[model samples]
Target: MRSITSRRNVIMKAIVVFIITGLLTIPGYTLAGTSNISSNGTPHHPAFVESRDDLVNVQVAHRSSPSHPMAPNTADVNIIELLQQLNEPLILGYLENLTSFGPRETGTPSCDQAAHYIFDTFQNMGLVVRYHNYTDATVSGSNVEATLYGNDTTNIFIICGHYDSVAAGPGADDDGSGVAAVLAAAEIMRNYDFDHTVRFVAFSGEEQGLIGSYHYVQDAYNSNESIVAVLNADMIGFTATGSDGIVGKIFENPASEWIVSFTQDISVIYSDYIGIQLFPQGETWGSDHYYFWEYGYDAVFYHEYHFNDYYHSANDTIDRMNITYSTRFSRLILATLAQMAQQPVQQRPVLEISSISGGLGVTAQINNIGDANASDVKATILITGGLFNLINVQSTSEQTVLNAQGSMQSKAMVFRLGKILITVAADASNADQVTKQATGFLLGPFVLEVVIAP
Candidate 1:
């Protein structure tokens, strides 16, 4: 548990972001999967949580964490080399070109030109690319997708951002930022080796209720595709204070909770570059991630931490955003995709915590159950329970290493309160860069708070 003052401070920051941001939803196509339904039988996307409003729950999710929630180790994994290939000048050029095309409104000629630019860019990267063109009575839009295949084609990992905007603005911040990330990631990641497929997509008609994503998901369902996850970025360049700070939210649904957790862990590993702050927003109404979540797929939504005041307006232009921030976010995107594509550890290290007797010192055991060496193994503990659950419970971390089939142990003295909860988490990585985490909770009889009637 955290202090009320600290929690309230974060929530105050979150209220401002939702007020002026365009979100992206995830998975759904013409597939046979069932959409989530509420008790009233109305179609509902299981909203996850709120931005900073749900930070407490987010902390709880990380409380019983996995060793390697993300397949590969949390190390840099050649991602920095790939990120180095990210040409900021090129990204600026792309944003400039995209913004100059004016508002790429759904079904407009301007939008089509932007589509051609992306399509051509992907071709130059030598990726397997194509166009997802959609038509309605009013307007037609094209969604550009580029593919970099890995050893496992069945497990498709997608990263995308909407390209279209409202008819009023240039949309440099609303979406051009995200599109810029996609463009940059594509150019750099094309040279990498991945174990799973990567699809870099630029969606159109997003301002008109995620039309392009909906259309693509429909076809994807009809084609019977294996979509492991959809990582969507929208409005990621807008930093209210305009510094190098990379403030953003990691949004996902209940089924996709792992995505959020994994992302938070990944961000910690790359905190120097991404600096991403997690706000587990369960119910996000707008953007591409919504559609993916609707269709029963694991998806994640990335957006700026602070909302842009000129959102969805003509004033939305490249000059208003911090391009350096976008560069860092794009770098994190490729790194995450590459990490997920890495091969899994056949022999994973398992960490366990046991022997809880309040003040009785707790023990954490690490077993390198995998066939490789586990390096930089760390175990952490946190205990909170006192008068009003506020006191110096216990917080400590220990580190070590374990070879194949080897085991180790660490113990920390814990204070026993009338009723307290203990959180034990361990993280370790194999020599091959495959990582894993183990977490457990020892709960004492403690009721948090009263539930109010809705």
Candidate 2:
């Protein structure tokens, strides 16, 4: 009986060792079939993380680009012309409107007067204006909203600034700057007929924690309003002036990269001649834009990087303001709005396989459904798991074919066709890019098979 028991124990030990060996070999077996295989033919752990700081959770929606190919009407909206228009009368007029009382805090009589001034300005421009008013005790204020309808009323872009000045400070740079920019943009685009709608808002109670913006966003959401992006122009009046004073600042948000890119493109085109410096700040807390961003709305904060010292004190008056900076900033905002208003919709890519018989050469086509063209678009193939290693695919305006190296960033390759995967990956952008991956494999080899055999 003792001998039999010893033999059983040895067999059990062998079984456990075999189980451990199989478990250890499982990942290798699985990756061998997929594109996760290394150049040495060994399976590699696919680098797929749940979250990445730079990764954008982009939705392939049929939306239009904010860039319209149309030309601008006014050729001479230069610094001289812009500054001439934003003269002392206009600057002081706006400041007076802002500082009619000490601390035009929300819900105060001063707040109401500020709203009236903004509303009157919009009305005087001969454009339709609407106000979305709500009472909030936090800032103890009321909100003002104005909308200029376009050819397409279904889609709208929003521009907002806080009008209610702070209590201890005049809040000129804090928001009076933003309010002025909003008015300037409104006046410029008043007579223009756009393809998309625009809403110019002067928010109150921002010092009290974005109360007005919260109310506005809540109302829009409740009404099922379709707003694509919210461009918050706050505190752009004062900038670092000198020889290199042309700096364009935008606060960064992971969910709003597209908006930031769009603004950057416009700033590059419109302000580069002035030596424009485009800055993307990742951390900015105070402003009305935060409320819209909180609601998952694509929001971008436009400002000048180094604001002047006269921000929020008794000295935060209009005389110290930089009308040149304000004019340039306003013009940029107007240009962006005008361009986006007439943009064609963007299309998602559609992949179609044409011929796969050329051994390593796979040819296909990519169709763009959106009106906007993906000029630099490329393609890459990843083997689910097989002997065929996906190198790189290049896209042309007409076709996308697999290349030996698989460089996805090849500008020569336009992705009018579907991507072809072969021995190499087409570009570095897709080299580490993952389409799908498993977290952990505990059981056996994960095999991804690429069947080239007909």
Candidate 3:
């Protein structure tokens, strides 16, 4: 393994050169092979690119511009609620647990255990979970994914962090902070609905020259997934005492400039809530978000402006981190995601079944929460399964028109003996259908022990 001190010295020298020259150039690449040299023959940042073979066989993928353009908008009141839901204790707990696993180097038992822990946590959140396995000559590991499917499944938004740490330390601030942020976002955002799918990913083998992210991006490109944007958090926990204030540095490439602008807008609109300022920086390929750029996908890297001296060392632990600062960064990311996946701005009916109750019969409340009035609003209730399959009742609401924010109660539908499953649906001419299901036991019009499905 290369010496960490040497890498740090190289980075410091690069920074000095950049400062002295005041001339920043993009990293040069060849269509035939992988190289980090620029047109002037100067190598790019050595801290990020470990070896030339990391980029082998990686053809530059082409993609058209995004269909859903990002626009500057004020923070939504509902998104504020999501921001408030980011719990500091939960974030701390995740970080502490991750650091307890010791050095999680790729292909080691500790790294495998960390992967399973992340996978299990995502599974417990009731998300669609899976393991993306990859193998190369030097290392092999899996990337854990937890997906919250949206109304439009094709469009995707990703928030990711590397789970494997260096062999020297637990990597609490280096990346454990980032993994905690992703977990916290997933835990809270799963309860709400969005127009675009959100994926929480924890990658392994990142220390081995971005191996995990490279394979994952390759597969995503081959499958033709329409990835909208990616938010990658690497180190966001430390803030030195007597510093000016918490400042986040967001790094982006030319293709992802719009994402940085959108993030800046979000930071401003939510400044009162997050209390953290942002600085947009030029391209840097030191983190996992770099491969997305190679595949023609837009991505940004979120990093701390104040550098931590304990990075990649044995002293990088929870005691050195600031939980409040980390939680605030998570809030900023959650707010950005909420706005990016927001519903269309057009005025249309959004029908929902607010509630369903049973006493002498089953009744459901249909609500129109959209801005426009809904015409031809209809509701349906169907009950199936009971003793001898003899108790089945189906009913529909009377034809009606509902104004914006208007709600109507469905007529009671009575059913007889045995355990049953009830499915209620509501729809409008301008809105898509919404359905709710429940399981209950009915003893002659007295529905008992009803449980609703999520």
Candidate 4:
């Protein structure tokens, strides 16, 4: 008994609903307000629009983002001296040998030859060497892993670089520098013992969209491995004209920022030995680190700040590369890995507030009484119990490191006029915290009298 007009309205509403539902289900169809737009005002298609596999890969890449530990403020003497063993000539020799295999394109005989050379070198270093074989629809190759197993086998750290080149060139600068660095690191680090296992890996098929790395990471994930951190080096030997040979760039994603910060600390602590400075940059997807990020592991990519014009071409050879730069970069990475993999039975640092005084400000002397070095030490000064209990101020000192039996002074300027209870405390990573207290009369940037609390 419905009216003709009402019937017509109902049909029209159903039509509209059906049209919208159909549009929502279509691939590449985005709502008007929700469409992703590029910086140039063009409508950017979502990854799924081109291929559903791309969307799946992106989702997998964001599966897990782990945080890394804070960096230390000081370097170990043993590590510093060990770094002296890495020289320009040593790295150049490795690079020359790698490139001698010719262009190591994946699935080619040259690539197989290069893999064999790396495996043999690792075996010669007396490390636990193995070939991680992987086969996909496009490429099949073996990833070489040389492991220095730590006392704690559950925790693992990896330093890696690709060894494959494009079809056109030997790929010396593109990755030979990185491979050379890894081999040099393995040669030196094999003699030391660490708390966590360290892996030196050379992957192939990197030029073909990270095939080897992707396969390796996927398997590691499937086996439920606990990988602490990954440091990846690619194309780290080029120094352009007018560019400072000492400065290198480290690229990292948000999850791997701690690793970048840690590398920065290593650069500062070993600046004299490495002779290389580091600057942190945002994430890049062109290296093996991309696969680690995709599987939720924290990783950082080390590369030259100056791009190589000869990348992926026949011109990427030894003469065009800087061996000194490569050696320095390799030294920095080696120092970082050595620290992250703590030495077995190493003594922990002990921090103590040796003395507290007030003059132009409140000053506290912090000392490392333990046999080990104290890093990222911080001293804090607190003032309270002034006139009418109106004073409650606090100040902290800049973070620093104290070698065994070494001491540093931390001061906080005060501008109050009254009697105050002063509490001074100092702490550091891997060290015991210490505190001291005293009653002082402050007179405009100076303490007239202080009574030490027993």
Candidate 5:
């Protein structure tokens, strides 16, 4: 393993002299490869084997890679490392403190202690924190909020989890995992600078039908807060099932497809899970994210995607959690926040021509209205009734370049997402045409027609 100092040096070099063009021109690639294509007939480059299947394809019923060589360049995020170090222990300690308070049921004494603990932690992080207080029947609780102002309030990114634990279960996997993830993310994010404001929130009364979250959402609406996305981490700590009856699952709310997709993209490089699982059923109304989604804000929930058999049981203790998994999961959240905090709000492509056909080769163009550029242009040409579906990519085409100037075009294909829709995005750093160039550019959507006869 390389020393931290060595890693820092490489990272500095990559930052100082990283040529975007050269990085895109590696030879015999397996990861994300960039290329320049020529329409004029020429010898074709060999396609490298895919390292993973496209998750978007699995979710949206479509999906779509490459390599280039350059002088050895490396980078390590010291901030990420430092943040991880600072937040990991803080999270463990927070969990310990919560355990001390006992099971935090809605309107219970333990719940109040947990709430105050979260609020104080936010204040300690040097954030401008507040509470969205409300009541349900006899119970009154608040959604703790911590804000770090950025360039604009209209561009807001929220990271949240529920702090309240269940009564009979102790609620370790149910939410203690999520609360830990949120606290850790907050501690790390507090030290960073972003172009958009970031909100770190912990809601109480989630297990009791999202009362706390509902109150917070109403508060946001009343205050006219411009929330772009809500990243709800609920039950992220439970990573394993022991022989004594433990169920561990990871959940990413389906409503948060965009957020999930972006997170998964980064996870491909930084985390253990390569198969980015999207579309895991509808919102269960189990966590805080549902409140945000219900109120018209884009929201996604994150958790292990299985059942914790010890759920709602006293055995749902912290010892059963995969600490190593939790630690890595925290890092994944860190990387995602770092990347997203720097990005403009995400925007899906406006489908111009849903389907196009010509038995002969046809072209498609999709527009991206978001400030960020779209890359990893995957055009899946499927033969509806035939036994063939052609996959074409402009990100690796030597002749096709989809820059901020215009939509990327494929070398007119005969069989496309036949009578079907296609999706495009920045799948890799090499294919990110909008990196710095897309900082302020609002490119158009991908408009393409498919071939029905051919």
Candidate 6:
């Protein structure tokens, strides 16, 4: 184990980093490797990938690997440690304070009180806080946003939950659980250093069909703000049955599956001691994430798996919630947000294409060129024959995950005659794809270069 010292000198929270050893296998899907070619070689690619679900499940081992599958890197471990700073008493206290304001209904004084409390809490954590006010025919309210700036100010990740609840009594479980989780995550992560900006947002008017989120996204989109991802927690305190019952649902869209899967992986690796289940399901409507998804950004939802019988009633108090379970959600979600915001100290992988014979094929070289490991790397080739006939081929002859300065080469497909140019596209993990092109004018071992900067 290594000692961690925050650059900001925010008192580091002591925590035990658990090293988990287990694998969850997906039932049906498997990555079937093959020679991937034909005699008159044109890459056999089923357009549109059939379904994104077939790609990968970060939680479960879609296939067996000799190395520790989905192992946590330094940043991941550090983020988990930071998330472990979440305490049940702290979250319970926030819940108590929030519920004390009574039902935070839109257009009500209670709603204003709740927003101010969230703003004050964020300010006390040394975060940049603001209130987004909007008005509609039926009601008007505010969305509170707090930002913990990272090295990169352009890329923003959000952890948002609604504070205003339905006209239902005190609205504790309806949204207080979610607000607590968001506040707790923000508090725990405040002292840490991140490479990407993270926003702790408390949305109002969610009960009125996600009004606050809608306005926020609309404003953000119009301003050309880049929202990398949104993780929304709602009603995570209540269990379906008794104290023994421990399960919650992680809902997501195709674009958001990666976030959901990454979160599920954290639940397994870092905090299984919570003895709770994270059931990932659905691609439909609900929560603040819904509006983000509607606007074509990546987003996910976290909620109690089973509907609470006492939800929206006066009986829905702190006593009715399983505080331990609620604490688990805060910890789990905080870890996810922390890990996503923590960019490891690594440069992006660079691609170089060498030994292009003009007619047959080309050797594509991919170098990690970074301190941290880069996984799930892929190199794709495209060639243009006569009169704009485009051909696609798999450039990577082998798997492309690379260590620091590690390099791997692949012999791409042998294109037919009259090929004008060969283009290679390379992407690793969460990094975007970069392309390099070579024209057939090459006479010697063709050298192609592509550099992806961090």
Count of clashes, each model: 35, 45, 0, 2, 43, 0
Q: Is candidate 2 or candidate 6 better by lDDT?
A: 6
What does the lDDT read for residue 233 in candidate 1? 84
Better candidate by lDDT, 2 or 4: 4
Every candidate's lDDT: 0.65, 0.55, 0.79, 0.78, 0.54, 0.66
lDDT of 1: 0.65
TM-score for each model? 0.61, 0.60, 0.65, 0.65, 0.57, 0.61
Alpha-carbon shift of residue 258 in model 4 (angstroms): 0.3
Per-residue alpha-carbon lDDT of candidate 5 for residues 1-454, written as tens digits (9 for 90 to 100): 9999999999988874554323223221122344443221111110111212310111111111011111111223643464346444666776777667778887888888888988898899899988778876746887788998887666677888777776875667567777787788787777768777888888887666666787787667666676766777766665444321222223334334556666665665543332233333444445566556555566766666444567666888888776555565656666666566666443333212223323234333443333334455443222111112223223222223234334443323222222232222222232322110000100112223332221
Q: Quote the positional error of residue 225 for candidate 1 in Å.
A: 1.0
lDDT score of residue 20 within candidate 6: 11
Output candidate 1 Cα RMSD. Answer: 17.9
Candidate 1 residues lying further than 4 Å off, grouped into runs, are: 1-72, 242-244, 345-454
User: Compared with the true structure, what per-residue lDDT tens digits does model 6 show for residues 374-446?
Assistant: 6777766554442233333344544646675677665554423333466666666644344566665222123
Ranking by lDDT: 3, 4, 6, 1, 2, 5
Error (Å) of candidate 3 at residue 361 is 81
TM-score: the better of candidates 1 and 5: 1
Alpha carbon deviation, residue 408, candidate 3 (Å): 55
User: Quick one: best lDDT, which candidate?
Assistant: 3
Q: What is the lDDT of residue 316 in candidate 5?
A: 80
Model 4 / residue 81 / CA error / Å = 1.7
Model 3 poorest ten-residue lDDT run: 26-35
The better-scoring model by lDDT among 1 and 3 is 3
Residue 37 shift from truth in candidate 1, angstroms: 13
Q: What number of backbone clashes does candidate 3 have, counting pairs of residues 3 or more apart or in separate chains?
A: 0
Q: Model 1, range 291-387, lDDT digits (tens) per residue?
A: 6665545688877777778887889888888778777777777677767766451344434333232223444454555555667876554444443
